[model samples]
Target chain A: MPESTFLDSTELVLNMGPQHPSTHGVLRVILKLDGEKVLGTDCVIGYLHRGVEKIAENRTYAQFNPYVDRMDYVAAISNGLGYCLAIEKLLNVEAPPRAQAVRVILTELNRIASHLVWLGTHALDIGAITPVFYCFREREEALKIFENYCGARLTTHAFRIGGLQYETYDGFEKEVLAFCDMFLPKVDEYEELLTNNRIWAGRLKHVGVLNAEECKEYGVTGPVLRAAGVKWDLRKAQPYSGYQQYDFEIPTCENGDTYDRYTVRIEEMRQSARIMRQAVEKLAAGPIMAKVPKVIKPPVGEVYVSIEAPKGELGYYVVSDGTTQPYRVRVRPPSFVNLQALGRMVAGGLVADVVAIIGTLDIVLGEVDR
Target chain B: MADEQKPAGSPSPAPSGAGGVNPKAGPAAGAPKTAPPKPAAAAPPKPPAIMAATPWDSELARDLRDRFPDQIGETSTYLGQDFLIAKPDAIISILEYLKLEADFDYLVDITAVDWPKKPERFELVYILYSFAHNRRVRVKTSIADGYRPASAVGVHLTANWLEREVYDMFGIEFAGHPDLRRILLPEEWQGFPLRKEYSIVQQDERWVRENLGIESGQ
Candidate 1:
């Protein structure tokens, strides 16, 4: 017997954005919703894809350094570090001690800057505007330090194949020290504003809870996985670029909720500061460049190198065929993988909580779409 | 020193005393020598073999070899790393066995390489990581022109998008990929741009025409 179907009970399909403001960046999230609760969410990326890997196959090894910065513009230096480390591993070259120390300082500063942008915009998305301004004030100082070193701020192509393109400029250390002196106090100010504020707590606490098992199943890392109580930071588990020498803590939270994610990142900014301070103190004198062959031709082989990028484990897999150009280059972008867990996290939550969950994930769409 | 003698941009040949025939330089010329006579006195207790049988356990390699002898072309255990090379058709079966029997749950990455000089135009590489065992294995399969390899998307859901990306760039088809649409490029784009022969000039024209259709000529 055929039963009569009712069309009135059907779920509404909403297009959240190939253009909407809060989808992060040209990301189109196809949402199937029933009333105010989300039934399902399908994330459609690639809108901002520039074919970076394809472009890398044609460009010389030296020429690809700058392009890596565009993959995650918010954390430009970290992306550059990942690509450079992969290339360096293939070539079997090690950067000088001073260069490694400087790289640690710069990348940690970049991590702080990236987290500030995420906190500010993420808070703004949830209707907290004052924190955005405060976040930018601190971020400006970090950008100035970057500009002093590389003559560029936002998309700094500071790294090179073998080592740094140039040594730290005169007065660079003084400027970075000044920023750090002021920056730690600014982190406390941010904590006072949002960390314990009742409204902020109400909005975030227990809103998007994803436990450690679920995090691993979905492959979410960085703050998301740490908040879920997994102590699997690539920096600690598998150190690359001399991360083993640094003394910093990997902060974790047991709740695995939106508030936990926020707290973890806040604590991470402090640890990044601690790491930067150690890097500056231990800074040494040596040649920045490694003694690499001029026309670099690594024997045919493939190497996968990953770093603890601000978002998560940003890995680069490079295939060399004894030539200047790489045979293949694949980037295991953290945002793209981390964003896969969004649907599971947001399925049963209210529409308002979706913004909070997205904030907690802290995804940069350029990294995702790349 | 070898570093001083080598000129810029030239590939340095391996030293003659090094083991194996240097790939760049042909085998060294020398007459064969007879084995030396054994000493009359009892030889000092043979030093324990300096080299372990292979860094990786040979029994595991033998087990894998026995399981897929027909499909596996080679099993290499060097420096505590294992590499298994197989035909394109048998990748899914081998991967499934690894995932089910062994606990290699994570598909770390999937990539492809182009070798213009080889009989096979492309080599599809899959790296799997096992968190349980704290070990990693690399599987490679060579594909000739216009042929497709069986997809591993059935084993790990994450491989669906990754395989699509590999197909999009390398123009190598995955026979059983659920959704094989163009990911980075527009659906109507003419050719796979990452292949060695794909022209950058063609991309320039396409970029201009797509962005500014009528004004491209001007």
Candidate 2:
């Protein structure tokens, strides 16, 4: 204590949320700070743990399809698609062409909806509240399509195991295409509001930079990895659910800053819209469901199927021991793995930049703690 | 039985027997509607067993086996996916070999499966994706309970939290984890929920009662 001097660096520990509002959800980050600069961050998660993987073991394959939607509620359709694809692979029967087209349209629409929520809230966290209103208003249109197709908004278990639960509604293609037409112009409106703003650029430009090498090493994925110049998307990489037929580009940025992530996600919304329009055009009338047995007793084996969720790679590794219920269903949730890079991303940044970086990561705590 | 098994394919059986009665009957008793797929006793074996995943040796698997003949066990392909079962002791070498030599740069996920009945009760699964090759491979190794497997954080930084997750959910400890207390559950919480014996509704009731002043919360 006597040797303490002004030149000697001392760190102060700050406890930021198990309930702090700025944090996305119940994420408690123990921040070691040297004045304004952050020394390191320890993310204390699991406040919303529901033991979802354990729940899968107790439920049958068809019974557990809806449970996946709760993990990433914002992108619930994407989760449903991943689970359905995994089960279908386990059963060794592909969904009919019509079902595959509808799945593509719904999942791509969910991608846009998810990115809108992220853009709105992320901008709101950084003091740009105007885009939030515009974002949600446009999001309502997409949610309307979801409601019309599946009678639910957020956690819509839209797809069943082998195929869709219901056939496409009378105007499913028309409605989804209408949403696409109405959605693209609104994306431009939100971009006009924040993309060139002075404070938006200043707060995000050089803040919390993680490069390409570090991104892969830390296993950070989705837009965060793409923003770091890694040209990787699970849709393009693995091509599940007929994504190969859809033509789109993976947007990447040289700088992996918060601003770059914002740009990457914004461009991603455009590409998703492109996919939805194409999927609508590609929608041909055919049988929806495959010849799945009354009891779905898959062989004793395993299959890993991943889809490009709105967040990142949402993978389902389903192990079947020749039973109706899966032996093990381990979800490699993107947000959970993406959240691990928080300490690395927030290290050595300003304490104030912590929220911006967390917002930039775009983590959903339900998926993180599931 | 053959007609019932191939409801759409075998139209010859419907013409041979009761063809006149089937025509006179109403829509409920149609000729093609012989019976549901269940009651026809001589149904063939499920096609999935014939298509079940088997031990496969691809060019890459053969190359890997040549390098680590003693360590590699079964290299199986299931539904177009290839996974290798490796020995627990040589996991790091195999992972490093794949990373450096085979260009499996991205460690996609790390999860563990609990097989309580087996002598090696824990099967650790590592899913690795290679960007250069545009392929993914699963590497699994089984170990006895309470065995402190070497931590993979040194080889792949992504394994830090993923391994901690497996440890938190299954109570398997890694030997060299930097901070492996608990990621999802609290420090005071007990029981690994993902283990097979742990029921779905099970929770750490003592911790809940002490912290929240409630008897139990699940």
List candidate 2 segments past 4 Å from native: A1-9, B1-51
Tens digits of per-residue lDDT for model 2 on A147-259? 88878899898887677756778988888888888888988888888999999999999888999988889888899999999999988888877889999999999999999
Q: What is the per-residue lDDT of model 2 for residues B53-75, given as tens digits with 9 covering 90 to 100? A: 57877788998999999999989
Which pairs of residues have clashing backbones in candidate 1? none
Residue B60 miss distance in model 2 (angstroms): 2.2
| lDDT of model number 1 | 0.77
**How high is the CA lDDT of each candidate model?**
0.77, 0.84
lDDT per residue as tens, model 1, A1-370: 1133344456789878888767677877788776667778877788887778877877667666778899999999999999988888876778888889899999999999999999998889878899999999999999998988877898888777667767788877777778888999999999999988899999999888998877755667788989999877888887777889999899999999999999999999999998888888888788787765444556666677888999998988887766557778889888887887888888887777877887778888888877
Once fitted onto the true fold, the runs of candidate 1 whose alpha carbons sit more than 4 angstroms away are A1-8, B1-63, B76-82, B100-102, B116-119, B132-134, B145-148, B203-218
- Give per-residue lDDT, candidate 1, residue A357: 83
Which consecutive 10 residues in model 1 chain B have the weakest lDDT in total? B25-34
RMSD of each: 10.8, 7.4
- Quote the lDDT for A293 in model 2: 58
